[model samples]
Target: MLLYCFTSARTGEVHESTARRASAREKTAKESDEDLEARVMAACYKVYKEDVPLFFFNIFTFFLPLASADYAFRDYSSAHKILDAAEAYNIDPLENNILEVIHFEDSIRDVPLFRPLSELQVTKSTGRSRGADVFRKEFASLGHRSGYTRNVTIRSCRRWALMQVDKNYSKTARMKFASYVSRDTHSKHYAHPLSEVEGLANYLGIESRNDHIQNRRGMGMHHNP
Candidate 1:
């Protein structure tokens, strides 16, 4: 049931139908543009379920404004909804984008949403500083900030911070960050066995396996001599 609600909200099929009906009514009436718009907005609200997913709510709140200048100019309600939804969901991207639009649009900045930006900024800064302090403690515990371990620790901390800020952050990016950090630290500090090297070389389509053995012997001889 929740999935169905999410799908309906995400696709805006229901809203589209409501809009079409509103248009039909508009054609029959001599209503002004503002009245027609208000009626449509009211119709859209009537279909909203109480348990609408935060994701859909967040998208619905600000997407219209970003997508259409005319909507942004006339839709203070959407702007207000975005402010409430963003705060409720702790969605930084939504908050940031809407704040940016309000900042530059000038025409709508005086609305109630604009007044909250300063408070939001302070709250975000405080949260970031708290995260930084926690990171510092964790990083300090790793000790000796100039080594491979330090680099890995830093990357891990950064990944954690990204997760905190955005729940929808890419899983592939997280995997890549982890994979690269692990591979780098292992390659730099741990020597692979000869069999492992030969297997890896074979996998990579490098020349005959004997080359690596011969190179190792050559390096050993050079060091000894």
Candidate 2:
């Protein structure tokens, strides 16, 4: 609507308050725009059956690259019922598109169904997933379970703090903070390979937004829905 305000403005000048609130609203809208993809990526991770960090993991992980055009999420939302239509009070994603969502059933079962963003509240979880140990092991166990040299690589994440934050903490009481950063970084890096998830999408006959990128060139602009 903010974009439209300028396009439909009278002599291209809107009230100052309108301009201010519109800019804020645009930012808020952009934030809400991310909801669908975040869930889709979370769903991708869920299929992995591996544990992950809470909160930020749902919105971002190396698993789902939020690198697509803004319109891509809308495309998924339209077909897969990614957003609850009743509460979202939004238009249909497939209103004029050639592709219809075929991945989800009329009643979705595997993927989680979420309420509209307006009705949701964010909160921090006090506990990590039961699979966290498994996730950590996957990282440290990448090469070995630890045998001198292997121990160094696994402990390298912690040794990193000694040269960095540990020195400062040595003069204070903040060593734990450095440990937290290293643990979180390991989990964030390979939230399970992106290609693996995309491959799953292809196997399931779900048309992914990434497909648009590859096809857009060979088939021209309107080639994808």
Candidate 3:
């Protein structure tokens, strides 16, 4: 209506007197609808379920009280429903993206659904500090991380940590490696393996060939996340 008024005025098709009357009536018509307007205001509540955030919805709906008295009815019930739904189901979406240290805790508690800590093959380190021993003591009786001797060609443990954190392997590759290592480590799946350990070593410039190196490396070998 504003545009029509402007266009009409510019073209001189409507007299100023006529434009004034039309604008007044248009403004009155806009303000006159109470029920239809209120329903429209109520309908805005649907934004809660859409991409909009709950806080935004709350602020927008707060002005519902400022609407014409008839249009001021608030939808607190709908708002509460939306807030409840978000709280109930809103897992930190980023949790799925990153492997967190806490995930190991969950994996431990859930058992069988996720890989146990013992499944990740870690090379034995030197010394009797027992870092590897501690890592193994609390889990399934699988892979051995013992003191290394001259004959054992143990890989770097850091590489294993890197693979745990950053590497992405094909499902087929993972299953095949898991099967092969499990046979040696005595498990069905291998969580930490040669590639992972190798990757970590390369990144950290730590050569963990035996428990001597691993002992020096200590808990630093496992990826933090």
Candidate 4:
């Protein structure tokens, strides 16, 4: 017997090109009920989950489902039954579930803009520690949001990660963020798009608001990436 090997350039893995086909053929000859069933289930998922016409099943599932079908195409009703049984899940429910646990504060103050670093009294304010903890927790939680779903989280994580620990280190963002914290004349200050997540008092879900001075009209998420 000649063994055929094919190397896939994308993944850089050597594949035993004939192994599956040969095993499937051997299985066809012996016809073990359990092995055939597993193959049948796999084929069923591929066909149902993907939008493909029945005639095109051969091209899609590597002809594996067709082989496992055991006259599945011939028996049209049985094929329909298999296809209809495939499972799919909606992520809206997952997002809703996440929203349920998240809390938001409507009256939260943004950091003061351009406040001299000398003015901050982190030791006197309990809110400062609490807010920082929320940002940190938001960064630590969740499997990543695909795009901008966690835009707030993304910005918070970025700022927190990029910040220098040394007190005197002057990053452009630090004072602007301080201004945001003070919530003083936030109307006059311009914030980076990523820092926009800090507007909420404390929250995970998104909120819609209109600030005529800075954004005039806009929507933003309330938390970290």
Q: By TM-score, rank the candidates, best first.
A: 2, 1, 3, 4
Off by over 4 Å in 1: 1-80, 83-100, 104-128, 138-154, 157-225
**True-structure RMSD for candidate 1:** 21.2
Residue 186, model 1: lDDT of: 30
Off by over 4 Å in 2: 1-130, 145-149, 152-155, 168-170, 173-176, 179-225
RMSD of each: 21.2, 23.3, 30.6, 27.9
> In order, how many clashes per candidate?
0, 0, 14, 18
Best by TM-score: 2
Summarize candidate 4's per-residue lDDT along 52-150 as a digit string, tens digits: 333333333433343233232322334444444332322333322321111112222222211123423422322221222232344445424433454
Worst 10 residues of 4 by lDDT: 1-10
Error of 2 at 69 (Å): 14
Give the distance in Å from residue 93's predicted Cα in candidate 4 to where it truly belongs: 33
What is the lDDT, from 0 to 100, of the residue 168 in candidate 2? Answer: 41
lDDT computed for candidate 2: 0.30
Worst 10 residues of 3 by lDDT: 7-16
Task: Give the Cα lDDT of each candidate.
Answer: 0.35, 0.30, 0.29, 0.30
Report the lDDT tens digits of candidate 1 across residue range 22-98.
44454658765554432232222224332433345453454344423323333344555655645785655543243
Worst 10 residues of 2 by lDDT: 8-17
Off by over 4 Å in 3: 1-54, 60-77, 93-225
Error of 3 at 108 (Å): 51
Candidate 3: Cα lDDT at 165: 30
